[model samples]
Target chain A: MSTPLISIRDLHVSFHTQDGVVKAVDGVSFDVMPGETLGIVGESGSGKSVTANAIMRLNFGTQVDVSGEIIMNGKNLLEVDDDELRTLRGRQMAMVFQDPLTALNPFYTVGNQIAEAYLIHHPKATKSEVREIVLNAMVKVGIPEPTKRMDSYPHEFSGGMRQRIVIAIALVNNPQLLIADEPTTALDVTVQAQILELIGTLQEEYGSAVMLITHDLGVIAETADRVMVMYAGHAVELANVDELFETPTHPYTVGLLGSVHSLDDSSRGALQTISGTPPSLINLPTGCAFHPRCRFELGENSLCRTEAPQLHAVGKSRSACHLPESQLLQIGAKGGV
Target chain B: MIYFVIRRLLFAVVLLFVVSFFTYVLFTALPTNPAALTCGKNCTPEVIARNEVRLGYDQPIHVQYGRFLKGIFAGRTYGPEGASVHCPAPALGYSFEYHECVTDLITRTFPVTLSVAIGAFVLWMGIGVGLGTLAALRRGRWQDRFATTFSVVGISLPTFFFALLAILVIVIWGGLLDFPQYTGFTENPIKWFSGLLLPWATLAILSASTYVRLTRNGILEVMNEEFVRLGLAKGVKRRTLIIKYVMRAAMVPIVTIAGLDFAALLGGAVITESVFNLPGMGKLSIRAVTDSDLPVLVATTLVAAVLIVVANAVVDILYGFLDPRVREKV
Candidate 1:
């Protein structure tokens, strides 16, 4: 896998707020292979975005407490100084935020913002070089008449166009890793499809590892090569896109897929919904955090209540559940596939 | 942009007229008679009647207001017969107390007030915006605490009291500054600056406190904006992130308030000017009031009205420059 572009091993992020500690991202481990797309799917507060932000060390020196190694090219990002991190951030990895309207500074022109990242990494680049890079990125992101739109403020552009500019800014430096935190969540469905396609095309051209974070499983289905399903700040399932869809080993994944009504479905009924809200990170459920909301706790085995399940191989994937393999397969057949 | 300016100027002109009308009516309605005050302690009822006729006090309020407007446009003569003096165009009538033209007095004293106001404006804006940004950056730290404490002291302390105390410390005790005196800029630039230094610092201290609080709040709000985070993600230097993204955005509100404060200061830093014994507009206005110089009072009030309206208009225009939403409206 070319040593995987970046490796995150047991990354933990907690915030020490005034009220108490919030365990935002709890012991997550993953790797992004070069030119591959890894989707982290979860609802709000599930820590998908937090995990992405931690890779860039965006939470450093705040109330956040981050532990464990984020190794890229044989160096721990967490241990790097401000100077090293500054050089590494946009040059090696960059992030696109969720809200395009707010993601861009309204005061500056779009071209200036794109050029900012390029200039920071290539400080010795001339003004003409910077301009070329900025124009190329704008065109690459499918912005029509890049020259005309380059000088416009963010407010002057439509929501979809603004997101395109933001994507252009992120890709300007040609970073090895691109973290998109719900890049299209703020756009309408049509625009979302276009942005997704654009991202796919650009990823192919750049050959950079992508970490796509979103709450929509549908988005992950279309764009991600591999998927990681998170629930209550824990990785509940991890698998290839086809394998995960064909047989979801985790009960939460089954519930998530079951809720999505498709045109091809033979059974016509109301969508099945998962019950109960996500557990509070401050005071999580004692055993498995999802067990209280999970419907598949068996009669004989009380281990789901007394002990937390750890990730283990099920088929071609891994899941965090204590249910026997046969029962999981039955659940998957009855719901997902 | 032209339409915006024309609209703002039209509004300003209307506002000035309204302000001047009210001031004129209020001064005329006062219990003391302008003519009688001018006539002094002379005993005869005949003298009082003649003085009223000469001063145009015998005419109705509307008639006097009309004549007053006319005098501003075209030169007019004041008093009666042989003693009547010719007041030039933009005339504001004659000051009974000083036996001088009100407009002339205002024009003479205006330069001193403007110099003081401008110097103090620079001082306050620099201190307020600079410290405010610093306090916001170092929030929850000792520097922020010190700025907060300084602001509290500035807000609560009276301007006159602060002026006096500053004089005692800087001029009398420390000899760090010269006692304020009105030296015209054209005459001696060094003396003019040194003389106004104490007044500048005193005014800055009072005004900067508010700016500090405003700036700190503004910067804090801007820091939370998503663009700031994006700037950081772009590997922008920390200093660039703050100045380019945060500070520029934060300056909008600060600049707005500063314009208004400047207008207020120009209208008169009465207490500050009085403490320093500088012959600025505030002192002139005070003298007019104590002596019951109706012409001088009304004229100064009108000037203040004009200053405030013009200042507001200027601020509005400047706001458009900072915020694109306003700029694009034109």
Candidate 2:
């Protein structure tokens, strides 16, 4: 296949503390294609934002020890210079944060902020041209009176409006990749839907790859083209969205499906919670990080505790679980229900 | 903007009037006679009453207050010593002790006082804010540790000690500096600055410690705000983001408290000026208080009161600018 938009190889991200070194992202690997909306689903503290920030080189000032190849566009992102990295961000890859309330500067007028962001990448655009684009983006994101509201500060805008402004800023440069870190988690459900719809429309218009990070399976189900399930700093499953949702091969994926299954579908019984909180990345288990939680274990599935599993194709999806072919079919069937 | 400014100015005028009236009431309500303090301790009760009649102290309190306020606003001609002394517009009063109008003394001396205050304000704020930003950026590093330690020592050491240390270092021990006392800047600018340098340095040492602590805390808090991380993700050049976004946002409360502190510093500069032997307003204020000179006392108090009001107004205007949450009534 042609090169994916992003390919991580043997990525190790660690932090040195007085207590010890914490391996936050341990030997993680994945690939995403251009124009694909890949959902990275994980609970809080699962190193989701860290992975995205690392790709954007936002981790420079932070004290993180990282080694591995983050290949994008045939270039090793790990080796990119500071100035080059800046040019890449917001122009090639923009990020939207979770808290819409604080996403914009309080002192600046919302219109000026959007205009300023647009100017950063496209410096030749005149004032009216920039304002035109800002208003269009704001209106497209469903904001009202774009002209009047543009002169207002961040506080004057509601939580939803502010999120829309943030969306406007992220799409101001028409970046090739958008990294949204739980962008809808802080807003009300109705507002979240509006923002999600905005993202969907903008993504189609711009045709940019989106790495949407959230533990909300509902969001991924509604928006992502493909989904990657992460556990303990590792991607446990990667597959096309429909294939993974209809038939998850990994036990962890099965557990996640059971927990997030909607009751409106009647086929799903009482929701099954995944039994425990996500394992801490600071001290992950020896073998498969999900081994202790997996119930479909057989002997030298003792090997499952001692040896880590790679992403091997079981059916239409790849899973990092050491289950037999028969058991994979059973897991997938159970997940489909 | 002008309407808001005018409103604030009106408030200031009312506030000054109330304060000057309160000063009059306080002196009248005193247990002893003002004429006794004005005349000699040897003067008997009859002589004191004679002096009181001559000085307008024998009049009703409101009339006495009217005369005082009139002296400050327009002018006054008081014949307390059997001769009329015409004090012109903006005159505070005739200082029987200084043998000149109190407003004239304050006017002649305000520049020196202002220079020392402004210099100290700039020194502490510049050094304090710079060190604070450095410390916050290098949070756990030696730079942070050093700043913390230095601030602790700076806050603990009294201004008198710092003034003496500088005097000892430059004047006595180092023998490299000699700042002659009481040369007004208008008379000789260079000598005036030299005379006041040690006092300004002394004033800055303590004031800067608090400012450093305040700014460090402010920057650290602003850094924690998710908006800062959002700016970073927006690819705002780190330097530009720090200056334009982070620092500007962090300056809100710091500016408010700093303005109030600057006003208070003029009041608190007594020790600093005394140690350096500078004859500025602080020293003048100390003498006025000791001698119970009503004219000088009331004049200095009024000046300090006006400074406070002006400073507060500036801070409030800045308040509307820094935090856009503060909506101006257009």
Candidate 3:
């Protein structure tokens, strides 16, 4: 897989808060192949965002405790010194944040904001060179009249335009990897499609591996090559998007699919839903974090209550569940519990 | 931008006229007679009546106010023809209390007050913003705790009390320097700085506490803004992020408050001036109140109003430069 542009192994991130230590991310591992999109889908507080932030070391310098190996270009991101990390951040991997309105500084012109990121990596570049690059970036992101709009502040633009500016800033450095955390959540439905399309187009153009983090299943279905379903800070399932959608082995994945409202399926009854809210990270249920919300019955002497399930091969996917592969297949064939 | 400033200045001029009219009317309504006061202890009825005619107090209130306004533009003549003393155009008024022009008293005492204001402003901004930034950067550490304690103590102490305590500790006990005295900055810059140091420190300590709270909270809030985080994610150095992203945003409110505070100080540091025995506008105004010197009181009030109005305009213009959002609106 082209040596996997970035590899994460057994990543764990915990935040020390007043209540207790929140295990925001726990023992999650994945790989992003060069020039491919990896979608991380989870509900809020499921540590999807936390995992992405950990890769960039954005979770550092706070009360967060992170330990694991994030190997990018053969260097462990978690172990690299701050200077090296900074040098790699925008130059090798850049991030597009969720809220465009706030992601860009209001005091600076959009052009200057984009130029700032570029200049950090190209400090000795002349002013004219920087301006030309900034203008080109603005145009690449579909911003009309780049020169006229360059000097406008973030507040002066519409929501979609602002997101475009943010995307422009992220892509200006032409990093090898792009981590977009809910890049369309703050945008309207129509703009969401445009932004997703823009990211896809940019990915193809730049040949940069993309890590797309969002809770929207449709977004993943539309863009992701490989999908990772996360629950309570754990990766419950990982597989190619088609295989995962057609034969989701994990009960949590099944529940997620069952909950989605299919426009073409009018015969389907009231939308199916998981029985409970997500478990608190500070104090999760025993054995399986998803057990409390899982619908399938647990037979006598079931290990689901006493021992945690580890990720294991099940059909075409890897799932963390105590159920036998045959039984899971039968349940998956039935669509949901 | 120029249009906005010009509009604000025009507004200020109208506001000054309204303010001066109010002050003139309020002081004139008082029971004390300015002619009687100026007539001295050996004054007789005839002498007081003659003094009233010369001072134009005998005219109706509105007419006197009109003449007062006119005197500001065209010099007024006092007493009879040949013996007339012509107060220059742009005159504030004649201060019979100080036996000098009201404008002259202000021009002289304004320097003292201005010296105090500038010194105190510099001290407060430097210490307040500096310590506040330090505290915010080292939040929850010992440095933050120290700054918090200092601010609480400063906020609790009144200006007069702090001034006296400062004198007692620095001058009487520690023998650090002489007691504060007003000295012209151009005459002897060294003595002037030394003389104003105590008042400056006293005023700054009292005022700096507010700014410390403002700056500390402002920085802490801005540090959490999404833009600052984005800046960090963009590989900007931590120092650059804190200064350019965090501080640049935080300084808006701080500058707004600092401008108003400095302008208010320019009106006079009343208690601080009295405690330091500096012949500033604050002390002059206080004396005007005690002696019922209406003209001096009116002039000081007008000067204070002008200072505040001008400061507000300046702050509005500065706001445009600080934040682009404001610039477009202007």
Candidate 4:
């Protein structure tokens, strides 16, 4: 529909390390629609952050080997030169890192830093105009006394406020695509709610697509429009947010949803956790990365080991397990921890 | 700030007094006799005893120290033991061996030491920091490799080795620049500069090498900081980011070490100064040692301690300014 705002195809990213090649993002494919909030769900080392960095092109010369088309506005982002990537990072796409405390220059006033973002794209802006725009951005993110706070250094702001300042810098440019990697993980729960709400409002007002990467399913449940579930660098499930929760197909997604504490059942049992650590990408399982942890333990787990399963649909949901069509509840009963 | 300065001054005074006492004890404990030095080398034993008695060397040690401390503030007149030892206002003590007022000697030497120190500090930092930034900008490239290799070579070589190598390259072998000889800055700044050119290069080579390693490491660390990456993610150009953000952020740690090195150099590098024969602080110290000029030696040590403390305080303030983390605590 109108050529997805951003499209990625068969993205493969491997990091060359001292001990062999580690496949970080293996055969990931996804798209984001204009003005939509697309939540990428995965635990640490699932390659979600790498995929986001691939879009911005700031992840350079890091022993990273990347392939596949990142078609955005009709050009593969992977092929853009460094200069164009520099321009693209702030003018078109921007990112917000997870650690709010360490995400702003300690020497600069918050106002100067935000204004720097705006001026980078429009370098000739008058000082007064830049000030106005920067303060407005702070205001939009709900910072009090925005004008005064602008001149204060990063340490002067509380953690929540610093996160807001980062958001201000990211949104000050009105970028076309925003990649926020766990932007609220550092804040208190209340502040996290406020920040998530602010980002949603900003996206709506600016009409820019958002690629929000986080492991917290609750965050996705509250904020995401459509969701992509990644496990071991592969998109195991993709569906509308409601469909994902209501009729999940991926075993990893099922484990994730069950792991999240729900309202009525919150008191009935201890919070569930997915069994086993996510596999090391350096020496991943022979076939379906999830097979070792999967159930329906077919004889020798043959299909899973010999042939990797491509994502297949079952009704309104998709899963990447080798099980043929079966009752979703039974499959989960077999796969669930 | 005023309170901090007052406390600092009080600390300096007490510290100087302690340092002076130690220097006095060490000087008195030496085998050489101050009484004989004050009288004459060939003076008879009877004459030396009379001179020692007259000079207050026979007085209790504490009383002698009290007199010496008082002399530093107001003034003093003492015989090199019943002879004539008249010193002016702001007198520290009289050196029997040097046959000169200790205060005058120190005051003259202080200016010479400071001139060399300030001049070389400016030059060394400029070259070191400039090279460091360029290397960081081209990280992983050949220039970065060159800087890395150079830093290894520069750091591995002893300070004395560099000083000698510089002398050979710039003075003796090259002959493009003359061997350094000290010229007072007040007399002729041009001559002072040229005369110290070889010394400057020598100091620069010794000092610049350390700065290059520190600065490269500092800048590289700053570049990897999360904020820097976030700064780029926010659309700031790389050049602006490097200039305004990374270097400024890196300078706090670098400046602290630089201030420490500055104070250390002020005391002197004996080998470097000796090789150059510049008659700077180190050479003065060596001369004082050989002559057993107790007052001058004590005064020099106290002067060095004061400079180091002041520099440390300045660095703390500068670090607070450059690093918000420091300012917030204060």
TM-score of each: 0.95, 0.92, 0.96, 0.92
Please write out the lDDT profile of model 3 over residues A57-116, one tens digit for every residue. Answer: 987866889998999989999999999999998889999999998999999899999999
Writing each residue's lDDT as its tens digit, candidate 2 over B62-109 gives: 998888877766788754566658889887777767778777888777
Q: How many residue pairs clash (N, CA or C atoms closer than 3 angstroms) in each of the candidate models, in the order given?
A: 0, 1, 0, 1
The top-ranked prediction according to TM-score is: 3
Score candidate 2 by TM-score against the native: 0.92
Q: What clash pairs does model 1 have?
A: none
Query: What is the Cα-based lDDT of residue B9 in candidate 4?
Result: 64
For model 4, the local distance difference test gives 0.81
Chain A TM-score, cand. 3: 0.97
| lDDT of residue B63 for candidate 2 | 93
> Model 2's lDDT to the true fold?
0.81
Residue B5, candidate 4: C-alpha displacement in angstroms = 5.4
lDDT of 4 by residue, B1-330 (tens): 455555556776676667678877776777777777776668899988887887778888888888877787778887843457789767777777767888878777777677778888888898788777778778888888887777677678887777788878877889977777778877888889998776666677667777877888899898889998898787677777888878888888888999988998898656767887766677777887887776677777766776787787777767666777777675
Q: Residue by residue across A134-227, what tens digits does model 4's lDDT show? A: 9899999999998778889999989999999998999888988999999999899999999999899999899988999999988998899999
What ranking emerges by TM-score with the best candidate at the front? 3, 1, 4, 2
Model 4 clash pairs are: B55-B81
lDDT (C-alpha, whole model) for all candidates: 0.88, 0.81, 0.90, 0.81
Error of 2 at A207 (Å): 0.9
